[model samples]
Target: MRYSSITDRLADLGSEKWALHIRARQMQASGTDVIQLTIGEPDMPTDPLLIAEAQRAMNAGRYRYSNGRGEPSVVNALTARYTRRRADVTAENVLCFPGTQTALFAVMLGLVEAGDGVLVGDPLYATYDGVIQSTGAHRVTVPLKPEHGFHMQAADLEKAITPKCRVLLLNTPHNPTGAVLTADEIKAIGDICRKHDLWIVCDEVYEELIFNGPFASPFDDPELAERTVVVSSISKSHAAPGFRSGWAVGPVEFASRLLPVSETMLFGVQPFIADMTAYALTHDIGTSAAMRTSYKTRADLIVEGLSNVPGIVPLPPEAGMFTLIDVAGTGLTGEAFAWMLLEQEHVAVMPGSSFGVEAASFVRVSLTVPDTVIQEACARITKLAIRLLTPKERRA
Candidate 1:
């Protein structure tokens, strides 16, 4: 039986990282009560305006084959949106895709190849390894420390860069840890990339989910414009995940070069979806604002609920929909704690190790759940921590 090498590269990189989540779903399928906080599917529904736009387009029979570049209206909307951030952004710089994941895949394919190294922050998003590997490029991790609030430091990026490195895969308002890069941080990292001649591929899927300060990215800097490519989607910002609408905004040349790569993967996103996306981008549908408040509140709840718990310390996130809780004081690795929590407490959360080495002793709880569920999950998590760290003699 012949199989592509990509299958091997992705063999251990796939569902294994999601084992805890999968197990949680299985338990719930069996009628078990589980407060699952593993994945970051937005709790909010898609805005009615966006849905109506999709419906209108579909009724008008906008369901036709679209060019690899994207539908013109959607492209224009993206251009206008990004141009506001960086005045030079135009239709030529936009390439629409199904989601951030797909846009990243195309960007990787266009930027690196076999024997190349991708400099990424440790404790990166789970699928990043697979994405890099699928392109036959190896991932080189730069440790992101807790003292830095998990933001990738320029010094770390400089130390991790090698002659073989071709790209810096970055995520801000980052997944798992939710650390948003400051403007200065972005410039510093961009400077390193400039010195090393590496392309900056940033995933900004959570751009609008910020709670601390304004969002920042290399793409926003005119100096880094040529080398920076930002991929984002409405999945999080607009609570429109099911629509599968996303895109890559980079230099016009990068978009031109990546066109074939994108076409090879997907001819183009559904045109009707593009119309919905355009509307989502241009209109203030209130989804991101609502989500920002909700997720921020939930993050606060997780920290407030577990901060003084016996053996767990919840790290507050600056942005994004997940909070990391360090379980090292409980004498358990994140993997062990997550499984035990699911089994003993009927609460499911992702083990931090699922992301990367730096997060090994932490568990990531999604803030996408209802407030009551978060409170209950925190209570149960506290109970488990107390039981684990308490003296056996005290537990009659």
Candidate 2:
């Protein structure tokens, strides 16, 4: 019997972040005190209303095949949610999926061909590269500079686009940097895409997670609305990662194109999850609000506490639960700094390289832990940064 070597796409991809997360979890399981800030999972519980609704559905024998597109109520509630945000959405534009990750993959597979180029931001969501590679498309990363506050200019995006540029991937408030793109900025990209006949897939999974300022989106432009597919989920908003509920919204034609790919991949997303998600979307406003407020408070605490630490610049994030610290001058690589923090102070942070190529000198710290845990982690990191930055002779 002969086994096959993995394809180059799978063979070449590396996931240091997942490995670190797994190791951290294992260490914690062994009773070691590890402050995990690597993954983006919410620490809060699922919305109680959703739980109750799911129980009701189960009791009513609602276990059956889902409409491949999604539960009608789920789609309607999603339309209501997005319309409230931007006023341009309708239920027909929505496509439901088991998870935002799955929705995103479906969008990519539907839009791109083998060897077609896709533009993703650096530092970006790490899983994006894998998705692009497996789709047989080339990943062209547009660097988001620290000096520019991780904001990409329109001209920069133009230069990154080639004839093969089939898709432009965007996220806001961005994961590591938390830079939210303004409406004007979005239009600029929209204009470019419209000119070049390129499609877009905006991953707004963190849209509701904004910390400061109003959210701006490419979908806000009606001109680009048809070509743009927005992928979002209930996981972050409701603290229900296990629920596996998400949706994709675009013009009916574009939505229709993506649905077949999704159906082939998943047959359909779980209906009970969709039913629960609809209940949560309609009735769990309080849960989302409370979690948002909680994260905002945590963000403030970490930013204020870490401000006093020298040689580390905490770029204030406008949204999302992450902060990217400039660790270039620490005379240590981001990975080294992260491992040192883990070993010496027992705090685990994801290295910025996990996101994109240009974030090598930065490290992302998430605010998912409790406030006490956050304070403890901050103090520990403060001490570590001080030691690393302070002169050896100054240490008494």
Candidate 3:
């Protein structure tokens, strides 16, 4: 038996990235005192209002097959949300999907193909390379340097562009690094995209998790609106990951063009979920602000706890629920450090190499855990780092 080329293309995408996380879960299941901080799932529970909305819709018989576009409730809610940022947005500009991952998949499939390129920042979201590969497009990475606070540089984007590049995939409040682009930075990057005629596909699932300042996107710029597609969901914002409700907002023409691709992949999300999403979007549900504070506090805990520890440097995030700590000073690659930390200290974190080469000497710690877990994890991490340091290195 044989599989399609898509399997071959994604053979080494990111399966190994979860090995430590899986091991951590196995240990935890056996009652090991493991502090697992590898994933970014929100610790907050989904709001009852949203759940009731789904129940109401289901009882009202919304379980029937829906049109490919989306139920009116979600479509309208998305339109109103994006329209406030850009006046030209309309219902036709939005297409609902199961989640940000699926939206990115369909959007990439619609935008690029074999022999094309997707220029994405290194240390990107784990699934991005696979999404690009599924469309037969190769990923061209632009480094998001730690010196730049992990933000993507406009000049770097300009330098990385090639004729084969058709899309610039970005994850703001980025995964692993949690670097958020400022408004001016977005303008500069948008200028480069405008000049090069590249499609901007932004993954903004963490849009509401910003701690430093306002969130900015290429889709917020009127001039680049035609070329920008913003994909987001309630997973992070409303603490509704289980609902799997997300959407893509782009030009009307792009939505019109991508609908069939989306329909082919998934005709429409569950109507009850769409209704729940609508309520989540329109209401002033308090999850985003709450998570923002909680995650920021956890990040600060990591920084404060590890600042004086030998052979480790915690990079506090500007936004999002994870922080990257450079472990190069420990004289170990992130993978080795991560494995040792889990084995010796009973803690688990994602190695930076899992994200990209740029973060090879770093490890990503999730802020999704409670403060106590974060504090304990930091102590364990510090213990491991200090143990790894040679007496000579410690003196220096």
Return whichever of 1 and 2 wins on TM-score.
Answer: 1
Those runs of model 2 whose alpha carbons end farther than 4 Å from true positions after fitting are: 1-7, 12-15, 83-90, 389-396
Instruction: Report the lDDT tens digits of candidate 3 across residue range 1-396.
Output: 989999899888766778899999999999998887998888899988988999999999999998799999999999999989999999999999999888999999999999999999999888888999998999999999999998999999999999999999988979989899999999999999999999999999888899977888889898998899999999989988878888999999999999999999889999999999999889999989999999999999999999999889999999998999999988899999999999899999999988999999999999988999899998888878887878887688
How large is the C-alpha RMSD of every model relative to the true structure?
1.4, 2.1, 1.1
Q: Of 2 and 3, which scores higher on lDDT?
A: 3
Model 3 / residue 214 / CA error / Å = 1.4
Rank all candidate structures by their lDDT, best first, as comma-separated numbers. 1, 3, 2
Count backbone clashes in candidate 1.
0
Model 2 C-alpha lDDT versus the unseen true structure: 0.81
Which digits, one per residue and each the tens of the lDDT, describe model 1 over residues 1-396?
Answer: 999999998999989989989999999999999998999999898888988999999999999999799999899999999989999888999999998888988899999999999999999999999889998999999999999899899999999988899999999979989999999999999999999999999899999889967888899899999899999999999988888889999998899988988998889989999999988888778998899999999989988899888778899999988999999999999999999999999999999999999999999999998999999999999889888965862363
- Candidate no. 3 TM-score: 0.98
Cα displacement (Å) at residue 217, model 3 = 1.0
